[model samples]
Target: MLGVRLDTELEERLANVARTQGRSKSDIAREAVRRYVELHDEAFRREARRQSQRASRRDTQEDYAFWEQAEREDAAWR
Candidate 1:
């Protein structure tokens, strides 16, 4: 079990919401924590997927050669 301490005002608000919704404060807090963690985990997974996708894109020799040519042209112009 996790113990959390909230500000007095927030605690009172939570209690009012809990009473109005007919749900225990524990239940509401648990669901909120679960959803928060789920969103964060999902965001991590998406970033991992993006990194893997970028890693899968191979840079060919021709691409490197083009950049080299561009750099030489810029150096000459300087």
Candidate 2:
């Protein structure tokens, strides 16, 4: 068991949710914790995969295409 302190507004809202859903605040808290863990775990995994892919990339490309296009536009504008 755990004891937590909540502000008046949050306490009212939690109580309302508990009554409407026929659940205890503890149950709601448990579900929220579960959801947070699952969401962040998936997020971390995705970021790790992206980092690994970037690490495996041997060479990084410069934004030469954009620079070239900008130069061409500037030449036309002049």
Candidate 3:
């Protein structure tokens, strides 16, 4: 079981919100934690996808060789 210690003022705010929402403190805390984790996980996933796309845009040795050969052929025509 995990335990959290909140300052008195913070605890009071949480308690008030829980009362207003008609939720148990533990339930509210769990939902809040779940949403926080999900939000960050989604952001992390988006960044990872962007990083992969950036990496894929870079040239490989095979691509360089192919392009170089194509340039040489085009130069012969010039």
Candidate 4:
């Protein structure tokens, strides 16, 4: 559903590659776009996972600090 304009040389190069590879020009273009999208999606997922792990570590440290302080206060009151 997208309309794109190609220069004559670019069109010729694509046709030559497609012919050599025994693939339709549209098929080759579709595969190229698919690969680009997959690469970007994987990078996004990695960053999100890293952020989640960092947040979990921060929460665990805060919980431990809280309990440690509580224990100190209890010993002082005894």
The sequence of per-residue lDDT tens digits that candidate 4 reaches over residues 20-45 is 99999999888888999999999999
> Which candidate should be chosen as best, given lDDT against the real structure?
3
Off by over 4 Å in 3: 62-78
Model 1, span 26-61: residue lDDT tens: 999999999999999999999999998986786768
Error of 3 at 77 (Å): 44
Whole-model lDDT, model 3: 0.95
After superposing candidate 4 on the true structure, give the runs of residues whose Cα lies further than 4 Å from its correct spot: 59-78
1-78: candidate 2 lDDT, tens digit per residue: 667888999989998999999999889988988899999999999999999998677343445676788999999999
Ten-residue region with minimum lDDT total, candidate 2: 55-64
From the highest lDDT down, the ranking of the candidates is 3, 1, 4, 2
Candidate 1, run of 10 with poorest lDDT: 54-63
All candidates: TM-score: 0.73, 0.65, 0.74, 0.64
lDDT of 4: 0.92
Better of 2 and 4 by lDDT: 4
Clashes within 3 Å, all models in order: 0, 0, 0, 0
TM-score, cand. 4 vs. native: 0.64
Stretches of candidate 2 off by over 4 Å are 1-3, 59-78
Error of 1 at 20 (Å): 0.3
Which pairs of residues collide in model 4? none
